[model samples]
Target: MSKIDPELKKKLLKESQAPFKGLRKIVWIAFSGSAFLGLFIMLAKIASGNELQLNNLLIQLCACIVFPTLLFVDRNKD
Candidate 1:
């Protein structure tokens, strides 16, 4: 077999290392948006004096906190 060109080989390696980078970004944005939206809804319920279930409030709070923390960690990895 013929040898591969050095530049092309390097590019291939880089691309392979981060396959689906664009898709990953889109998923991250979607999750983060949903997390924030859930948090907003919870806040609105509180403001309107509607009682919230404990588990749901906890889950939303965790989602709101966890997604951004993960995003921050992922960013600093780059």
Candidate 2:
């Protein structure tokens, strides 16, 4: 029931990351790190009572969505 094509599999095994397992790990790390940075910055603003920035809001939104989605979606890739 395997879906892989044997010829393509051979070529992929000979090449770098032909199976693409590394991509999921890289994406997860990048997204999670970004989320942590955004959370830290947001806390800093709160601690100082700084004026709200619209771009910061956007960054938090991206981090929240991306991090959680990556967590669930990529859990099975390995």
Candidate 3:
């Protein structure tokens, strides 16, 4: 293997870190949006006078859990 120059290594480090600066904000937004959507669905059902069904709620919970889990798994793979 060839030795890497110091300046080139610094440049590469900066470039690698750049993409992650906004990643935290993006992840929070995605999670919040999903939670909001789930809440909206539950509220709509209540507003329409339907009984809160366990299956429906379970599905929403699964969606909330699954989405973040997928995001975490994908990010770690990199």
lDDT of 1 at 72: 66
Model 2 lDDT tens row, 1-78: 879999997777755544565676787888788888878788788789887777877878788788878777756544
Q: Which candidate should be chosen as best, given lDDT against the real structure?
A: 1
Considering every candidate listed, which one attains the maximal TM-score?
Answer: 1
Best of the two (1, 2) by TM-score = 1
For residues 1-78, could you state the per-residue lDDT of candidate 3 as single tens digits?
A: 749998999878875965564575577558857866986889798899989988878877777776676566545323
Q: Write the per-residue lDDT of candidate 1 for residues 1-78, one digit (tens) a residue.
A: 749998999978877987876676677778889999988989999999999999998998898888777676655253
- For residue 7, give model 3's deviation from the true position in Å: 14
Worst 10 residues of 3 by lDDT: 69-78
TM-score of 3: 0.42
State the TM-score for model 2.
0.55
TM-scores, all candidates, are 0.76, 0.55, 0.42
